[model samples]
Target: MSLRQTVAKYFTNHAETRERHDDPALVSHYYKTTKDKAMAKLEEMFSDQQLYDLNAISKEHGEISVYTKKGRKVFIIVTVIMVRPFQTAIDFSVTSESALPFDFGHSNKIIQQLYAQIDQHFTPLDRN
Candidate 1:
């Protein structure tokens, strides 16, 4: 494995990171969707995986307090906002539940996968 992978494997216990994306097409869709509806959609997206302690903080923010299936507990916060007409931004904050200093890149992977899934399902607007 590479040096980065080695350190991630040996020295990390938890990880945290954030991602931001702008989706012009999703503004109206998100505005029309309720927080409960969004949370349900997220739950459905991860239905095949294990999740727990999921909560929607508001129409614009949601949190997942625990994810146990991955061996380490993970906490995730998702925020959605409308920046302008037909423009929406989504942000995600993910943190691992371990006491150790390293997270083995787990949190990064989670955010990547989430963005991939959301992009695939929702289809962002083309930049051109």
Candidate 2:
């Protein structure tokens, strides 16, 4: 295998692209809106990115799973947990599917891109 593939394999075996962020501001916004509405907005956001096969939408659990394609297939899981009335925690897990052993950080790039899109689409009301 190539060096890039070898390194990717090692890292994939040891680590994964799992990220968590707590956005009280987002929770506050969500609290003002209904869960179904929030889910619809999220679905729209994902669909805007051209994600496909979005399934397993659990409103009670505040979780959604979707798939997208770049050079390879990418699976994304998004979870929005209401910590309190105005506190929310979001988690993202991105995985890349490739025949080769290495993805050259494609999964991480996907997560970053997703985050950027979210921030762009949903700018926090409270900047401070």
Best by TM-score: 2
Give the least accurate 10-residue stretch of model 1, judged by summed lDDT: 20-29
What digit string (tens of lDDT, one per residue) describes model 2 on residues 30-116? 233344555667788877765566867888888899877444677778777554454444556667777765566566565556655
What is the Cα-based TM-score of model 1? 0.57
Clashing pairs in 1: 12-102, 13-102, 14-102, 14-103
- Candidate 1 local lDDT, residue 39: 56
Q: Report the error of model 2 at residue 99, Å.
A: 0.8
lDDT of candidate model 1 versus the reference: 0.54
Clashing pairs in 2: none
Q: Cα RMSD to native, each candidate?
A: 6.8, 7.1
lDDT of 1 at 128: 27
